[model samples]
Target: MHSILESVKESPGFTTGLRLSDDDLVLVKNAISEHLANHLARIEPDKVPLLQTTALDMYHTIAGQLPHDKLLTRQSRILAQTAVDAIRTTSLFRQLESQLGAFEISDEENVGRESISIRLVRPGFDTDVGSLHADDWFWKLYDFPVPTGKRRVKIWIAICCEQGKSGLILCPNSHKRDWDYSVIERAGMSKPLLSPDENPDKQIFQSKPGDAVVFNYDLLHGGMVTRGERTRVSMEFTMLIPEDVYQH
Candidate 1:
């Protein structure tokens, strides 16, 4: 895999960064565990410890770890915010700040931040999770206009995911084209934007705790069903170029 800087410079849509330090992972994992524990205080107790282990178990434990359980309600929101806060303090983010101009963490006011979402993909269980897609498609569905001048980026962190199995896949250099504009209504709503027969510039790689991938908001990407017993748990938030930074 190319260094994060090289990948971004080559395509700017997808780049995986250096491994997140043990300290960084600890801060994020603990925060998520505490918040989820608070939310689960009344529903389930045994599953609280599972949150620290892997995302698949956390979702399954809370939802009963059943094939039928698909509800990821309030706890998903908590995970998203907890992730956003933790990622903001990372050295990767610090590097992004210098490259993309100063950024504000996702908040209610920032249209970009509102798109933040938590993702948990489990093997043999597919229901409410995401499919092949880009963030801007849904943003436009809600009538949010894509930024015209300043660049916008998405920050993704894998809390309990690894290489292979059910990890995210991306169609590289897919963001720079105009074809999606006309077909987004039909194609952008689902996962795997292209068929295996289509021969796209597909890319997949391994990731570990604290690993992050920052890409253009317009890139075509989504998770795959894991092949292993472990589940893929991750969170992503949006970053917008600061107006002042562009002004200078």
Candidate 2:
């Protein structure tokens, strides 16, 4: 059998038992739901009672505000704290250094970024999906320097995802090699364009509420939109480790 840590070192990424409790789940769901409804009440007052975001209304104008939403940023901090607490259940965060002393997880984003975000994926083929990409590619695009002695990794926890239905799509083992990309400048911002030949050997990792999916910063990943009805919600955060962990 392949070991978990070894799997992370050798492949695209792996899942862990770390999870949020039932109470935490309720807290996140309610808080975000109310927030989204309130966000719409400002412009579309009649739709407030629609219980949107949970069952998304494609016409809801809130999608334009996702990138800079302050409430989402604050919530990211709160969720990051939850992940740190959940680490007590597994040695993955603290004792992980035993396997690769070059890496470490700070309790907060003291050095890099919160990089924490909440996402809702509505089901159906008509739903818009994110382009194929990797987190670090954007980091480089923005010229954000990874702090010395720290390398980045991503943490994604399923807040309300349906099993085998909706969650993440990762390109297994794609992290080890550089994926060819071009920069497309728009609105004074540069975005990474995945080259045509560098397509992902996509792997759908369906996760449940509270399940944590830690993946490499270079991993080619994206969301899996479902034809089902339920909307998928998930939390994402980032942490760093010693820079040379992967070097010989």
Give the Cα lDDT of each candidate. Answer: 0.58, 0.61
Tell me the tens digit of each residue's lDDT in model 2 across 1-248: 22434555576455466566666666665555655566556656764555464244242234444432433333333434443344434433433444445344433434342334567666663334456688888776766667776767677778777788878887888878888888887435467878988767987776777677777777888878854546677767666755555443
Q: Count the backbone clashes (under 3 Å) in each candidate.
A: 8, 3
lDDT, residue 102, model 1? 63
| lDDT per residue as tens, model 1, 1-248 | 22443454357567876456778777766666565565554456565555445454345544544222223452244344545666568676666666655665444324334444556666667553555677677565555554555445676778776566656778788777643333323323422243444444667757766777877666777777766666666766666665444343
Find the candidate with the highest TM-score and give its number: 1
Q: Which residue pairs clash within candidate 1? A: 60-65, 131-191, 132-191, 132-192, 163-206, 165-227, 166-225, 166-226
TM-score of candidate 1 on Cα atoms, chains taken together: 0.71
**Can you list the residue pairs that collide in candidate 2?**
102-242, 103-242, 104-241
Which window of ten consecutive residues has the lowest lDDT sum in model 2? 68-77
Error of 2 at 191 (Å): 2.6
> Where in model 2 is the C-alpha error above 4 Å?
1-5, 34-113, 125-128, 185-189, 242-248
